[model samples]
Target: MIWALGIFAGAMVVPAVAAHASVEDSEVLAAYVQARAADASGALGQSARLHGAALALDPNNKILAARTLRQAIAAGDRPLAVQAARILDKAGELAPDGRMLVMAEALRRKQWKEAGLQIDGIEEDEVFSFLTPLLRGWLAFGARKGDPLAFLNQASTNALADAYAAEHRPLLLLARGKKEGVAELAKAASDDRAHSQRLRIAGAAILADEGDRKAALTLLEGDLPPIAIAREQLVAGKKLKGAIDTAQAGVAQLLVRLAVDLNAQNAGQLALSFARVATFLAPENSETWLVTSELLAAQDQHEAGLAAIANITADDPFASTAADTKLKLLIAAGRQEEALSQAEAAVAQPDADADDWARLGDLHVRMERPEDGAEAYGEAIARADSAVPGSTPKWALWLMRGSALIEADHWPEAKTALQTAYKLGPQEAQVLNYLGYSQLERRENMEEAERLIREASRLQPNDAAITDSLGWAYYLRGNLIDAIKTLEKAVQGQPADVTINEHLGDAYYSAGRRIDARYAWNAALVYADEEAAVRLRAKIEKGLKPELVSP
Candidate 1:
């Protein structure tokens, strides 16, 4: 059951302090400035190091210590967090988050009582109130002290948290070999639709473990989503595993859930540390590995992300998604050959699905193999059609096929597929943008193209790409005034976009603003693609070609 809870923890901002008469520490101030500069430059590790040095030089400054701790967390420096935590704790200034880190450390060490004590020190807040009992319940179950259901049942005050507890308690019960809570779990599974899929999957696991395969299959057949379908397939095919059974795994699940909360708050590196701890506790859990890899990638640690994704074994239900993620990371790291090889391998697998073929097509396109890309996209469409038979294939799949065909210069087939996609998803901005832009480039269906481009602009008013298309459509229709106004907006919204700036330059020249046109072309050269750069340089040297100049 996906008990999706959104509890955002706002980051604490440290206020900067000027050097006081009594605290005239030049070294500390200099280190602080260096740390700030490092943070602004995206050098998080350097920031963390400099902040630590500053904190060491001014240990008594609570604000500096707290800032250092935050930087350390962002850099994934556990030892540094511990060092900062000690200073905060000694001064009785540790906040709820600082306490949670200490609690996680205690949980890691299997010091149950110490973990409980740390939980007790958490400042009473909305999340704390919900989390406290849940933590205590998990501890009780782990420690064999009291009924987990009693503490879990107390979570009814909040609907979402209650749903989480309801979904969580059963997996723990089955893991511990207790059947007394089966009835309650079944009821909880039917309680809320938001989390029902995960609950049903959990229920199926429990039932299957108890040798009730028929009942388990029944649960799996009801209103199953895609992820649940994966679980159902694994369960029916006898490839699924039993529920999480260890105290460590239980704690890891808690930490993973907490990591999700932190991710929602955009605390990527801090969330990575929590996810890493979860993986350390339950190395076989594919979910934590996926999250850890994504967090690593978000922090620009591509190699580390690949390492985490590598841990997803073929037997895991998440393996395909993990493979796809790994391939993208490889491409991002400039290992296009490696990524293409991986994509080729995936499509060659006996059971590769339409999605796998689609991914392969994308990889080929990225590698600049347009013919191969067109062939792969065709195979994907064929597979999808064979799987679903005659229903309007996903608009996105058709859209992708259209794009590939366009790159291959097969205009008739490309136009057919794009029209099909546009018919299916008439209101989709991207579909409107691509089809309209393509028509503009081909200099056909000028009136229809203008309507489609204008509709796209209305749907996505802030989208610079869509605005660029609208401006281009106006330029093609000889509406120089409207073209100039719209292109200016597009350039303002995306000043660094080479194509948008080029269009703006064209609009300016057509409107007799030759000086502004030259300035825009010069700016476009800064970020232009090779072809665009050539065109921009020609325009700057001799102005727009005669036919393209103002009448």
Candidate 2:
């Protein structure tokens, strides 16, 4: 189950200190300025390097040391992080993250006592309090002193902490090679509320290693692409490597889980910090790298993100996920051509699945090649049909293909696809809305279109696009008063939506409110694409055409 945690506040802003006019001060200031700029641009490695340089010039600067420690950890520069952590610790300004870096180093050196002290020193805030017990447990396991399970099982009021405990207990047990680990893992995997894919994969790997191949296969029984890949590997007699086979790897897994949870909550920086630490601890774990790459991409560090995922080879279980992430990163970087090329290459592979073809279709649509998109989606549909014979048809794929066909002006083909989608998923609001709106635009089956739109509106009352479709249907039926009212509500829901605003403009002009019509048209023009802008400008200049309105 997904658990919500309170977001940690960002790093404390360093108050600027007035520096005496000197050559050294000027050099330090220049480096500091460059560091801030690099940080802003997501050049985290360069930022850390620059910050370290500035700190070297002014070693007594506590704020600079803190910033350096943070950026160093963020950049996955362990040596730099350790240096900055030492500086911060000496000055008694070490934050929890700095302490974490030091603790991580302690763990690496097998200094269990030092790691425990560092964990103890961490102020029990929302973020660390949740982790403190887990860290203690891992440290105990590594030291072979205390009962790690007891530390993990310590009851907590926080449900999220308890959930984490349930996940980690089994992992720690497995790491110790205990037979009970398999049963505990199976039990944990069966608890849907506390279930994790990591647990299942780990359990499956352990079971396979212990010759319980059937149980391993059962553990990974799912249609998800990752599960499928694992199952195929198992069938081929390949031993699936478990994520956590040691105390250090267990700690890394814990950090990776926290990183994922924090990223889900939109805490990108904090997530990156955790992910980087995990990477440092378990560089062999491709999952940590994947999380690191995704978090980097989210922060607009596309190049770094790509570089991070490059570590995952073609045979890695995470390769597919990495490829998908790479496509997104390329698109976000405005390298759509590169993304399109990758998508093409992916679908050209002999074993390419429906997902690969669908990705190509999506890329084509993004490039405005609607006809190509429709063709690619058709291939995806064929593959999907072959993959699951006589199963329920994939309504979503048909809907996408239909939308692309409509964009390409293949009306008959579009209608057939949309009808197929409606047949498969009549209750799906998106399918209903797309089919209804496409028919409305063509002025075909007007009565049926109205019925479909009304049902779609009922299913998704807050959806501005569906609401606009309903409003447009009213206008087409010559109910100008109701049209204006409904269209106004649609505009309120999405004021900047070009289609909604333009629809409102049309309704206003049809109702003889010329001034309101012009205002709405102008608003739409502000946000419209080139083609829509030209049309909106014409409507603003001469009002709606007489023949376009219902009599």
Candidate 3:
């Protein structure tokens, strides 16, 4: 079932229509089939158009109308979305989301009463009821009927809903020109969540507007690109603009937050619908465009994602994020060369920072140019070190450089980098596993490697790769029985991993299970890379040599 329908699973069941020989019925069926295929393939825009065509032929079909509404919202086709939404609304078959679409259109036109009616039409859906109070608050604020903050502050048992309400409470206060909002905003921005970061940015802008320069600067304390840009602007005595200046923008912020949460839950279509509505509410808001782009990319609509990202201007605080998303979309669309070119250009700028160099390194690594990746990572480490005098770069930077060096066969440097990473992040399981596995593979520091791998296994016992490393460690120690048992467990955890399968085969052969060893090797051959496939075939044919046996 589509994730959008998962929230109300089994609530609405469309009765199957009787087969008809009419040409109109045939055309509708063909279009519906084509729409389903397009949706499955992630061609959401095409799917929306096809669904619309099918619905046009069978205008009274509630199922077709609902499908068209969902597809239209996901594809950002506002006209079709409105048409389908109204159809369902008039028939009293509108889902919560359809009501939201109708409300969004009313909100767009400042038809507060119409929008309120649509909001009132929303039934108590488990997944959507949490938004009801917020919708009421924003609607009241827009219509000047009551205190918006009162509606937002109404107690709720839903923790997720409360968090969102808390986030919006300060913004609503600020929009009303209340000075008490500064303290509340400060409290909300203490968390590290993305929404909190946005609050921090908005709060800082509000402070700057109020001439509290010191407080504004203090709010923008992070090293993120957006914070850095905002800090620079504040330092230059420029007024930073607040995120939500109007009631429409407030609702847009709410929808964007909802969209992000839904997308994280793997409901891309539902998320896109909310994001599209947010774009209509706050068309110039860079954050809305960024969220829209990310959700579109999640659906494999890379070209459309790029188009959405292009809405962000270069001077926008989210420009860096937009650039990053554009790079991902380009790569996902098989335009690696363009992505590389953009990455290179970004790093070539005189003011390019560690992030730019790191992004270039990442792109190089993705393109299988590990040598270039190592070089770029080296530059990133250098710039990062310079960025904060006397402080070491982040452990992840060293780990990345180490991995790139290993891929490029620069083992000596890789070992040094990996050791540095381990020193900096001894508690990180990934760092422990990588460093230990590298030492094990090189036949160097065998006892130490085993110790590291053992600690990593303790840290993350369910991690298949680390478990496989522990098994391989036992095999190298000539503990054939334990090795076979551990390797078999590892195979069960990750049956398709070529290295783990090969290790199991090796352990089996050493345990005198010759037929079982051959079987394991044959299984490994099925999923092995070309190089590993040749080695596995040879192992299956002749088995392990006596001298090569661990025991």
Please give the lDDT score at residue 140 for candidate 1: 74
The C-alpha local distance difference test score for the whole of candidate 1 amounts to: 0.72
Off by over 4 Å in 3: 1-42, 50-61, 123-126, 239-242, 348-353, 382-396, 419-551
Best first by lDDT, ranked: 3, 2, 1
lDDT of 2 by residue, 189-250 (tens): 67332226556777778678778787777767765556667777888898786557666777
Candidate 1 per-residue lDDT over residues 1-551, each given as its tens digit = 11111001111232343333125566667667677766665566788898898887777777787888877765556778778877888899886667777776776677889878876876253445566667777777777888766877777887766756865787667656666446556676664242344445555666666776666665555422323544556555664542455566666666777777788898766687678767766777666777877887787767667877898886554555677788888987778888988788888998766777878888887777766887887787778755422122467777888998888888899999899889988998899999999998888999999999899899899999999999989998999998988989998899998888888888888788999999999888998778778788889888899544321
Tell me the spans in candidate 1 whose CA falls farther than 4 Å from its real position.
Answer: 1-98, 105-110, 123-129, 156-203, 218-237, 242-247, 348-353, 367-371, 384-396, 406-411, 418-551
What lDDT tens digits, residue by residue, belong to model 3 across residues 1-551? Answer: 46334223322322231032124566766667767767766677898998898778777777788889988887788999899988888888887777777888898889999988777776354458777788888888889999887887762667877888887888777767776777788787786565666677887776677677877777788665577777877787776754675668888888999899888898887888899988888876778888898888777788778878898887666666777788888999999999999899988999887778878888889889998998998898888865522122467788999999999999999999999999988988888999998988888898999899999999999988899899999889888888888888888988988888888889888888888888888888888888777677767777786443321
Q: Report the C-alpha displacement of residue 65, candidate 1, in angstroms.
A: 10
Question: What TM-score would candidate 2 get against the native?
Answer: 0.73
Query: Candidates' lDDT values, in order?
Result: 0.72, 0.79, 0.79
- After superposing candidate 2 on the true structure, give the runs of residues whose Cα lies further than 4 Å from its correct spot: 1-23, 40-42, 123-127, 176-195, 348-353, 382-397, 409-411, 421-551
> Candidate 2: RMSD over Cα atoms?
7.8
TM-score of 3: 0.73
